[model samples]
Target: MTQQEKNFEGSLKIRLYNTKSREVELFQPYFAPRVGIYSCGMTVYGYAHVGHIRTYTNSDVLRRLLEYAGYQVTQVMNVTDVGHMTSDEDAGEDKLELGARREGKTPWEIAEFYEDHFFSTIAECNITRPEVISRATEHIGEQIGLVKRLEDNGYTYKTDVGVIFDTSKFGRYAEFARLDLEGQEAGARVAVDDQRRNPQDFALWITNQPNHIMQWNSPWGRGFPGWHIECSAMAMRYLGDQVDIHTGGIDHIPVHHTNEIAQSECATGRQYVKYWFHSAFLNVDGRKMSKSLNNLYTLDDVRARGYSPLALRYLFLNGFYRRDMNFTWEALESAQRGLARLWGACAELPAPTGVVIPGFIEKFESAISNDLNTMNALAVVSGVLETKGPPESKASTIYKMDEVFGLDLANSRTRLSDFWRLRGLRPEHKMQAESMADKREKARKNKNFSEADRLRDRINNMGFQVEDTPQGPKIVPMFDFDFAAMRKPVCGHCGVDEKTGC
Candidate 1:
């Protein structure tokens, strides 16, 4: 065992809600201090939405907390640049093909454009990039090799369409998901193929499609690998047979992950994964985010509204990862306000002495270790802020907590100043407000209440508000400030404000 593992072996054991057993359990890697995590990444067919942001942020927290607990983690996330069909059952056109058709571009072009946007978006939210980024298109040879092995193991059968994994051959196929096979109806989604063995049978390698933009020579024929096989193959390729943790959104539990378990175990005859972690969905305005409702808000949309991406990340931290989170304009505004306060408080503190209170650290670590309950951890942050203590000590403690929160609180002064500037508070206006606030402070101290009220009104008129703190008076932009002129929607294509009829 490594020194890090040896140190933390007898310490607190991290608990996580494992989907395989549907309960919270103590987590321990097969090899001490060494962990391999496979995260289900985006398909790169479209722009990522807020739901994607929430899922990745939660995964980032998981990885960060594990590292904080002295685990040597290697995280792998796959990019599905090809072979993800619109339908979950391996029917319909490929999503990348559909995106290519939507815009006047090739499938390869669509993949690169959206993949760039997806990573950039997550980076802005301070989500840590995985150690290994595996692409399905680049690993086609490995996928084909995995399918060939399944065929040799007598777990696959060929049909007119493609090579399918016969679920009947694996008796424990439905055990992971606890699915009712008898109640399942065939042909309910896509048209049922007459030669298919069972409804649960999924494609391993698709053939007989001549017009597919991307295809390769496999044992079955000249076609692409199925969606489920791509993840199983690429995960095993990087993480090896002794994979520790697998994470994805909860929607993946039924079809995609279930198929992965069946095919992976049937081929290798070993347990595929130890812990299965799934994040819950994020909703908008108390309804599911959908294109029909036009509520598919992206990080770009959040920036267009003049809110920092970190503010959205802060909102995500307020809820448990296992429960659905509802997003609204008011909630986002409140989160932005709360984050501004945090940044402001950090700015007012003195230089850190590199000393942290042990009680606060213990409470914070305990909260995050309990299945990554960031909500409770955030409460401990509030307690630290409220407790009477030295300024440097509080600063030091909050900065240590930020190691997992990833909020960049160490540079709070610069970030707070930048946040106000991005919110349309001009430097000259900010100076003017500060001057007025200073005069108001003097007037209040001298018992000139009427003069203090007058100065406060003048500061408010300049599109800022003065908040009295123990440190001093702080100048902040008002939430209802008259900055709508600067917030008009811009034409995404031409980069012109919509007010000009672009």
Candidate 2:
């Protein structure tokens, strides 16, 4: 075996910060050489913003590192097409219904449309798709089965609204999140639901809400599964009764994940997850991203503002996943420049000779093993670029590092051209125009100006003008557009105009 292969063999212990334990713990799968991971996925109510991208990116790195460490990993992620409500608690409108109303479409249509956007956005960021993608709507039977188990175990109570998981029956319900049960208020964040015996009790099956757009016939009634129940049900369905790692946003700690633990463990009579992995929130301009502030930037927003989605991924890696990271246009610009240079350096390297610098590989592995310390891992990548070595060795080492980084460094040649063209250009429009331009280029090659003109006209209709340059078609937006300002919706939470910064 090559020396680099030897380096990755054994003695590579991974440590992850378990939100349940409140400390970094050594990661040992319950079953050797096999790891089960379940990451919380998009709700598919709207466009996946940059905040969602950061959490999924962190999850991707975790999965990639496990694979790199030679573990047979089964990663399951859920698409929350239904059940997720506006409030984490059962006190608000169904988010799918809300989105459907806004778009003048059915709940299912809204789900499919936004789900596609989520997948495409993550792809642009180079996040590896989970091996199993479970949708809440598709898994309704499983969700109902889980609720039945909870009911049979006497951990559930029937209410006018539906079947509610009785938090009082679970002794360790608050241990995962360390809740001050006595001090907690019932209606602090969401409206008080008197039907619940305890404020902490969450719904397992929601019923009696005739207005809910997405409904299913369940044992409880003709209703739907609750938001928290879907995750627990879906996670157990694919990854077995217990998962090695269950990842989500830190905001889920107090409510969403805490309820998941309560219901799942109570029903199964065993621990549901060994480790709880949570990523901190991504703030915009040092403030919480708010619709009122007009800062909930989506992947398309990032691209529309002349930045590579991969560059946004790079910015995310520079910060610790457990700590809140602030986002700004300035920071994104810096990330784009740094990524461009790295891609450029890779492009200039000599061809790989199937030799990886062992030292560099070891350091990169060490950083990722320590709670996915991507910021330090990125620093090690910088070190590899500067270290004196045979060019082939350096090239091979960087390529190996890309296994964990997922920067697409192996295709830096294409990225260099793509990245350069993307700068100072609205990437979303440019991307759309470029697709048409490519067809137009093909048509022109075939001496078909009429078809080329048709394609050009389509591009123009989409508010983009294509310039046939020596390099290729240069796509420029016909008008300078402040896409961000166009997204300035009234603050859904604060009930104020965004211009006033409520």
Candidate 3:
């Protein structure tokens, strides 16, 4: 083997729970030294809620961890601009069509709008964009090709509505979901079309009705691809017939992912994916997040309450990816405070200079390697901060941790400065504000309450707010900067401020 191969094989191993095996196992790539990852991307019907964000964030962390472990990772995320139905069972109107009708626009327009919004919000949380972002609507030909292969292979049969995959032909149909065939057969007749060969059988293509808006001419009689077929076709088209890893929400397991496995494997007669990773749900105030409950929150909702997007990211890191995360404002506030404390620590140190502390790095790698146990990984960060070490070492170590954490710790000082700049203060005003805050700190230390209050009022009057911290005082602008006032030039003709006439 080449030296590079040896290095990757010997690198700190990453372990993740495979939903297929239902056990945490060492991650072995199908192709050594290179990993192909396929994550189910947003459906793009509307603004993505926090529940959706949590799933994608977990996948991002997994990708980041693999990259950090020295794997050449090629990631593909499929944007479902078409085919996904209101009912996951392929029985209802397309979500994109519904959204388009509601907004009085084309389905294509609605997809583009929400897809842009989805990326914008996830970017706020520092998610790395996938290498290949395949859209279902753009890959209709590939989807039809895959279904044709399945049909030719005798794994698909014609249904009144479309071509359906014959789950009865795939012996391992219920393997991943551990479904009871008899039970499924009994319930399937009542819940779905009785004409289906088997209750568990799913559609590969859905024949469009007269009013369906996103129809494409296909071998399956001018129909659209089914929801499950999109990811399988796109993944195989981009990443090959077999991939290293596939990730999605747990909700995909029983139907979506299960069907992907069946179709992909039956088409190629090869194992489709080596590892299947699924993230659990997000609950709001101990209840499942739903529009009916009026508890579905978007990234804007978090920002509306003055919380940073990374703060919500930090909140997710506090829990295991495999466990359902309970979201509460109180819990989120706690995470925000914790993140601020870490950022505060970063501000006290200079730019990273020294090598990463070996002990801390080991513990962090170990934590993340063990099934992406980020909660424990975060505790290691807290431990590193409290360790008595050179300032440069701590900063350098935290910077290394942030690679996997995606919290932007190394740029905390810049973020802090920008925080104040957004409120209203100019660069010079920020400096002056800090100087006054130092004076107020000394005044309070000397027990001069009157003087301290006086200094506080003086800073506030200058349109800045001071927050006293153990490290000293942090200054922020009290309100939006009056840029118009700041832009007022001195009137050269009158020797006074142009706007103020002073």
Candidate 4:
């Protein structure tokens, strides 16, 4: 290993929320020198809601920070296109079917459309993509393979409704649910499903009817894989029988992920997951933003209401991931104004005097190392902003902290209105991006368009794309960037040149 990789993991502590512990514990991967992660991705029959963003971006940031901290991470995300039903019980219509009816398209079409949108939103939020993109439909064979393993192990039983997993066989099935044993036996909590053998048993596979538009033949007959089964099968197929981490929303704790554990552990006879990370809900005006409540917000909803996608991400980071965050347009506007200053802070980066603020940096690292205490870590970033130091050190600290905040702070001159105000540029990020355009005027005037285009390529690599139109080359940000620190070269098309004329 090179110095970058080697020096990265010298007993450095990271705390993660373990569902098993139900509290933050020091994060220790099952294997040293390698890490495996599995995140429950969206059920792609519809556009992702704020609820979706909560978990997806939370896990996304975690994975990125993990990599930034020097651990090699293999992350897998399941694209849940099949097997999810309207009811957690084995009886309702498939979620895909419901989505198709609502949208007047085939389930496959709905999946494709919404899946694309999901990816776009996540990427816009600056979440990194996983290494292995596993689709539940693509892993039918693997699901069947796992189901067979459970069947052979005597943990599965066929019934009139479907191939149900016998939770009685596992006996320890409800442990992950964190329910009191007495309350579970009395059915005192939660929506009840009497059909589920022991109030905890769940389906491994659901037999499909001939009229169903999305059914496939399986070892158990024509059926769809169970919702929980798909995640388990896809996760194990990619990460192995045991995984370092499994992440999803807090909503999944009661049924989806808990059942996943019962079935996965029943099949493999081993610990299913070491760490379970879940993000709390993002409330709108002190009320939970939920589909049933008709309070969900779409990306367009947020934009029309006049907030960037990132302000919402910032709002989330203010409160810890394990705690609920309330959203008000006023709050988001404040975040926007605050982040605008963040860009100016980056633009103002000065040289490091090599005077280490050990006291402050230690507190910051301590926050993150403690179960990714992002709220506190954010406090550290704020403190860094307040420190009287060389711009280089302050800027360097902000960049290191972005590894956890995922705020793109180092490159968000575009996101900050103050940045625009300070630079005397237009409010729109694209306008600021033009100021960061690369200079190729010398090469272009020399008619070495090749060199000029190469310069354009370099600018694009820095996340600005230029279009040569009759009006001249218009530069736009492919996304946000730290414009002040950007090496804005002279515009070739605009005839701006360094040391020579276009």
Candidate 5:
């Protein structure tokens, strides 16, 4: 291995809380230099809410950190275009079909519209796209093959409604969730699917009713794959029978992820995934976000409220991924001001022309290494700003740190410049803004409070806000800029700038 690889393997120990193990452990890739990751992606039945965004953002940070640690990482995310039911027990209507009926559109149209919206929303948060995005509708053959493997292995049984996985056959069925099988069997919460052999058994394929819109040919007759099977099939097809990591929301643990472990392990006759990572849910105003409560905030909703999407991203980083984050408008507004302050500080620093300060990068790496503790990593950023150091070294170190934070810190000046140009300001306006900002900093250092306040007010009246940071005083836009309007839509699948639409 090269020196860089040795450094990564030796020093970059990332400890993560594995849901399956129910404890934090050192992350060891199944393979040496290459790592395979599979994250459960959007169902595309509706616009992605803030809860979904939080999950994806956490996954994105994990991927970014791994790549930064000198690993060749391949990430595959599955888009559930079909076969996801409203109820996790597999009794409710298909989510896509339900969305189609609610929106007065075809199922395919509903999937396409929301899929586009999903990509657009994540892009606003600067999320890195996955290397391979697998769609369930496009991988029907693979899903069928997986069901056949399970049946041949005697892990499935025929049911009147569809083929179902025999959870009892898998001895370690509830090991991950530690479920109370007896309680579940005795409770009324279990869906009454008479076809199932046991209360905990879940569907592998669902025989479509005559009115169903999305159906495919299968040995079990015309039907669709189960929600859990789609993820297993697509994940194995792209990554392998076994992967380094699998990630999803905490809601997936008891049913979806447990079922995936049972069926995938039985079919492959090997360990399915080495690490299972789950992110906590986002609550709104100390209550769960529900459509009936009208508190399901989307990226568009944040934009409508004049808060940048990155503000929400920053808010997520403030809390640990495994800890529940409560979202209030008040919290979001505080995060917006926090992000503006960061941008303002970054704007004041000159372009990085010095080498990275020794010990600074190591401090950051250590913080994230400890169970992806982004909250501590953010605190390290604050420490960097407060430390007595050359501006060049601090700027360079922060630019490197943005690889994991994804805050676009290095381009703060460019973003501000673009905003000014879009507002019809000339180049001289930027020069004038910088000059006045310098004068304000000098006055503050000279203890001229009145002069400093006057200069600050002058900058604010010109549509710019001056923020004082540990490093120095900096300037930013008076209000949040519409980052989505700054660029045209780019196709997530095809790397083309789609002027009309993706």
Candidate 6:
């Protein structure tokens, strides 16, 4: 049994679809009790579309699920502010050139614009920054280090074009793709770039031409690190050379990430990463979103059409991670309705006993533990409401589940169709706010002044503050720290803000 399964029973222990085994195998971390994670992030050469959000949210969900399972997770995601090429196969100009040409801006301007906005988008979605958010352009020395190492180990050979890693030297070079080497060249991407020693071998570094805007000085000369080399160097520098989990879009599995694994493992003479995780794509009205197809949806596109970002997240959550989901305005509207209904139901329950329900928490935890089956865990959340329980227990449970869901369930009351804009809550369902309000009001009515203040503080912990007035006690929320902040931050595990001492 996996750690998740062992800890939580009655719920499906998360059986991850391990790319290694090609089956939903029990999730086992390389280092027991502590999990180290790396996620492939944006290239920042162009504007990010909703397609990008799909990948980030998938990673975010995995982080949330792992933490809820009672293991310490240290995650690292990179920012590719430089060195990604137009063709991931190492043939064309840098992608930043394409963005600059299309937008009539400098390559640096394009990178900074999208890179800044990318962080903004993540904040909007409530996805916390990784412990170490590295920039590929800043790590030129590190990439060069790995390139030299691969060269020293005979895993690399310098070609007229650049220094390339010889995939032929590594056993099972295309292992991730489950490819038969006999037919590798026949099916190779970019028509088997003739410069490569073997058809599968990719560039460790590429020479920068006059047209290439993102260039850096290296041992090879004035050039840039190949896209594959950046992730390998960055992941190793922060987490060890071998990591626990590597996540990204399924689209990366064939070419980009495949090259990364070959170069990384060959350079280090050890496993590159364990537990590869790839999320399915999002299709809109039966068509997949992509730049070439010109069907990508931007954040502004969704908002100009009057949709919230969370509405997009809620739509994705309605479907499972491994399955391709169809996105539509109607589908998102339906998710909004579901969210509203959930908040509506939350506004109507009775007062509490201040007791937490361990049994119910265990059940919900198990549901999410089993392969991040949020679809099932959500069903259990609804069940918690239906069952007989203290109002306090039910409220605490929803708050706990939101650790994975990232939904603002504790702060809204617009779901109840029957409930109007009664600022505090609608009396349809039992929410912690209503229960705490009841307690505070009772204390005020009895004139137990000290008890009223303490109950007000209890309400605040559940994400609302209470006040006793002439009419009654009014509740409001000052801060609501969700799952991302619940990790109990490791002191030296500083993020961008923590590193800057912000």
Largest lDDT belongs to which candidate? 1
Ranking by TM-score: 1, 3, 5, 2, 4, 6
lDDT for predicted candidate 4 compared with the true structure: 0.74
lDDT of 2 at 495: 20
Winner on lDDT (5 vs 6): 5
RMSD (Å) of each candidate, 1 decimal: 5.5, 11.6, 5.4, 10.7, 8.6, 12.7
User: Worst 10-residue stretch by lDDT in candidate 6?
Assistant: 489-498
Model 5: per-residue lDDT, tens digit, 139-197?
99999999999999999888776888999999999788999887765438655776667
**TM-score of model number 6:** 0.77
- The lDDT per prediction is 0.87, 0.84, 0.85, 0.74, 0.83, 0.73
lDDT by residue for model 2 over 1-502, one digit each (tens)? 4454444447578999998889999888777578899999988887899999999999998888888888888999999998877765664689899989988999999999999999999999999989999999999999999999989989988877788888988888888899999998768877777778888888889888888878889877799988788899899999899899999999999888988888888888889999999999999999999889999999888887778899998999999999999999999989988998898899989888858989888888888899999998889889988988888998999988888889999899888767545543335445556777788899999999998888787667555678888888877554333334433343322223447643
Instruction: Give the better candidate number (1 or 4) by TM-score.
Output: 1
Best by TM-score: 1
Q: List the residue pairs that clash in candidate 1.
A: none
State every prediction's TM-score relative to the real structure: 0.90, 0.82, 0.88, 0.78, 0.85, 0.77
What is the lDDT for 291 in model 4?
Answer: 75
**Residue-level lDDT tens digits of model 3 in 276-384:** 9999999999999988999999989887665678888999999988999999988987887787677778988887898899998999999999999899989988888
Let me know the TM-score candidate 5 reaches against the reference structure. 0.85
> How much is 496 displaced in model 1, in angstroms?
27
lDDT of 4 by residue, 75-193 (tens): 99989998777765566788888999998999999888988999888877777888998888889999999989999989887776678888778777667886665565445543666
lDDT of 5 at 432: 52
Error of 1 at 47 (Å): 1.1
Flag the better candidate by lDDT, 1 or 3: 1
Of 1 and 5, which scores higher on lDDT? 1
Candidate 6 per-residue lDDT, tens place, 1-502, comes to 5765345544324567777667777776766567788999898876677778877887888888887766678888888877666664665877887888899998788888999988888766667677888888888999999999888888878876689888888787667888776765553456656667677777888874656877888888888887788888888998888898999998888777888888888777788887888898888778977768777877777655545566667777777888898877778767766765676567664433346577767777776777777777788778888878878778877777888887766654532321222222222212545566786678778999788777665555444556557767665443222212323322121111233431
